[model samples]
Target: MRMGRLRHAMVCSSNQNRSMEAHSLLKRHSFDVASYGTGREVKLPGPSLREPNVYPFGTPYKHMFDELRRKDPDLYKRNGILPMLKRNCSVKLAPQRWQDNAADGCFDVVLTFEEKVFDLVVQDLSNREHKLMKTVLIINMDVKDNHEEAAAGGKLALELCQELEAVDCWEDSIDDIVAAFEKTNNKKLLYNISFY
Candidate 1:
């Protein structure tokens, strides 16, 4: 049984894939969860990966989904993009940036699916340490951008959250949280689609 509520932030490069999946799953499990993207400019697959439609961080999901559906129906449908976008839209209106939540300081744990996003969030927090001087555990778990990989990552995140909830010292130290997460999820691989 959960002792109390925990606020979590899941982040990735585009916010449309891995983090969003984790966000949805986490929320379903009754955690106060938010998802963000670390990209300076939001990107979506167009006719090809070589040419993607770029938007800003707060761009509405509906608009981007419509654009993608219109721009490249074949690629979008083939890659199972609409279902993800629809699920995102059902949960939230737009994508948020890591900077957007820094001022609020609402999250107890922040999980990033990629190293780039992890570094960006760490640097962002480091620059404003005085203003936001709270113990927020940040973890970098290597999860791929594909759907299968994202679902697997979401499962890992849910398991970690459950494990952390049961730990008494999870909030005291980041090292303890990481150790518990790794120990609880030792059999699961970080990058591949396992435990799904």
Candidate 2:
């Protein structure tokens, strides 16, 4: 385990250094920043969800919520309204983003299928001081297009993602997620180090 962790650390370090080298280019470019760690213990859906929840329906707008309530009543009831709704809707709290609303901030990502519906989502995660985000990413399951519509979809997704938020479209592990970020033009290291 120690060796495994050491290996992870080294790979991460090397990748991070490469990212550092891109600082000048990134500054000139428009990179999206995000960090994620995978856990098979909670492999509810795809690669990386902006929130922590992993429900079966994946949308809070309708049928999914009722489905979850019926399927996992025990797990559903104990978690409470927001969490239950999130779980049923396949959403979860954006850790850093939610505090402000608790502390008097705003709303964030509510739906996942459209950008025009951005404001409907709540901004549960934000660090105005650093511009860190709520749902740092929105992992998807498709990667087959490099056309204008696809690029537009990416931009729209970016729009839905908070100003400093992020999104991914993969089914791999966190290492792949990090590598994707590093290899893309949208990789930003918003908060490399933290007090916690």
Candidate 3:
């Protein structure tokens, strides 16, 4: 709304997949978008379910990609991590933690793809000092963490953003917008208002 487009933040447990997928889509649509993770460490699938490759928040996507490819090119490629990292590298330099990004500035809307992440984002916002006194809408639409689900969720997130963009005053029309979206998409959404 600031520049005739809603500034958005897409969040998930790890910025590598779901959030990044939506981030890419939103960026392509020319939305002011940023993506983040709620997890303490960035975690990705390893060779087995019991093992996961972990990195600190600031590790470059290229580094993770090269390291994973070196560790097991075939396995990572098969599991879609390689391709995901390649796509992530193109979207941004690294995975960022939501808690660590308070100074990154305000967003008009923050969308999380998981309930836990929504909680984390809400908690983070609540704990911050409300210097801007700006109201931000936080919405959660459950999205499964997988290639197909991420792709589908990205499109759905785009649709929701477009709906919001079309409104002259989002605050006044949010209820109707959410109701229409839920009825049409058959998806329940959880939303809250927080200050920036």
TM-score of 2: 0.19
lDDT of 1 by residue, 92-150 (tens): 89988777654665567788888878787777766664543556667779887889999
Best by TM-score: 3
* Highest-lDDT candidate: 3
User: Which stretches of model 2 miss by more than 4 angstroms?
Assistant: 1-58, 80-83, 86-196
TM-score against truth, every candidate: 0.85, 0.19, 0.96
Tens-digit lDDT track of model 2 for 1-196? 0111100000011111111122212222343232111111221211234543443211232343465456665654554432423422322222112121223321221212222112122222223343433322322312122233333434433432322233233122444544554456453322121111
Note the clash tally of each candidate: 0, 15, 0
Misplaced by over 4 Å in model 1 are 172-177, 183-196
Better of 1 and 2 by lDDT: 1
- Candidate 1 similarity to native, TM-score: 0.85
What is the clash count of model 1? 0
Estimate, for each residue in 1-196, the C-alpha lDDT of model 3 and write its tens digit.
4355589999999647889999999999889899988888999999787899999999999999999989999999999999999999999999888888945868999999999889988988899899889999999999999999999999999999999999888999999999999999999999999998
